[model samples]
Target: MRVFATLLRRDLAMLLPGGRRGQSLLPFLFFLAIAMLYPFAVGPDADLLRRTGGGVIWVAALLASILPLDRLVAPDIEQGVFDQLAIRGIADEAAIAIRVLAHWLSFAPLLMVAALPASVLLNLDGSTLSIVVLGLLAGTPGLAAIGVTIAALTAGLRGGTALAGLLLVPLATPILIFGAGSLARPDDGGILLAAAISLVALAIAPFAGGAAIRAARDS
Candidate 1:
């Protein structure tokens, strides 16, 4: 437990905004930029923006999640951080699980809060805004899992960063669908489904990332 806490703190220090590696802000800013700019791109159509805003926010969140992918696992692998952990009896899976939690913390909460102003910008009603915040809360964990897994898998390949971005979109579609789809019909259990999907993704990510790390270590 202490080891996990230690790792979590380390990962947060690396991944958090203005951390040593200087991440966190890109995704936050990117998410905000999308919300800020969407109105202009579509012109002053309040009704249309309100109607479509939830989905746009979902898409923006997913895309913004991608911005930090390359930094998630690659830096550790490169610096032999995982190797040091291995020496101390930490399994790659356990390490990855910690990272997944840290990764979610890096940006999800801020985006949820940002969704407030975004809601106002898009003219979202109270109900829709509530649903959007709820969906993001339920779904961003899955996005975080997907991001870390991709980062681990593509850790050493050439052009891995771009590939990571490309791979995330398709893999994250289920979360996006159910999460954003909830806005259309909030009481239809879409949030529950999104949460379930996130749980599944979260379950899979640690093992997948562990194996990918093992592979990277061998090659």
Candidate 2:
């Protein structure tokens, strides 16, 4: 328990905004940039913006989430942090599980907060904004999970960073589909489905990530 807390704190420090890597806010800013540019790209069509804006926000969020995937586990692996944790009898699964939480904390909430400005930029109405927020809250965990898992899997590989981004797109597309789909349709089921997918990912990430780390450690 104490060890987990310590690891969690370390992760938070490194992963949080303005941390050592200096890339913490990249995704956040990237998300906003897309939102801001979208209005200009599409021209001054209020109805068009209102209709497609949610999907655009969703796409922006997906891309932003990928920005940090490369560093998600590679840095820790390179620094022998995982090796030390193993020596200390802290299982990789536990470490990855904590990392998942830290990962989600690192960007998910900030993205939700950023969505406020994004909504304004895209001119989303109250109901659409509500759906967007709800969908993001339920879906970002899965994004974090997929990111961590892919990071673990590719930590030691050549071009792992590029590979991680490529891998993230397909894995996270479902979340994007349902989350963004909710905005297009008048149904709340999409949000619910997105939440279910997130729960499943959260449940499976620790074990899958743990195995990947072990494989990487051995090979």
Tens digits of per-residue lDDT for model 1, 24-142: 78898899899989999998898999899889999999999999998899989999999999889999999999999999999899899888988888888999989999999999999
lDDT of 2 at 127: 91
Highest-scoring model, lDDT: 1
lDDT of each: 0.92, 0.91
Q: Which residue runs of candidate 2 sit more than 4 Å off their true CA positions? A: none
Clashing pairs in 1: none
lDDT of 1 at 102: 97
The number of clashing residue pairs in model 1 is 0
Report clashes for each candidate as comma-separated counts. 0, 0
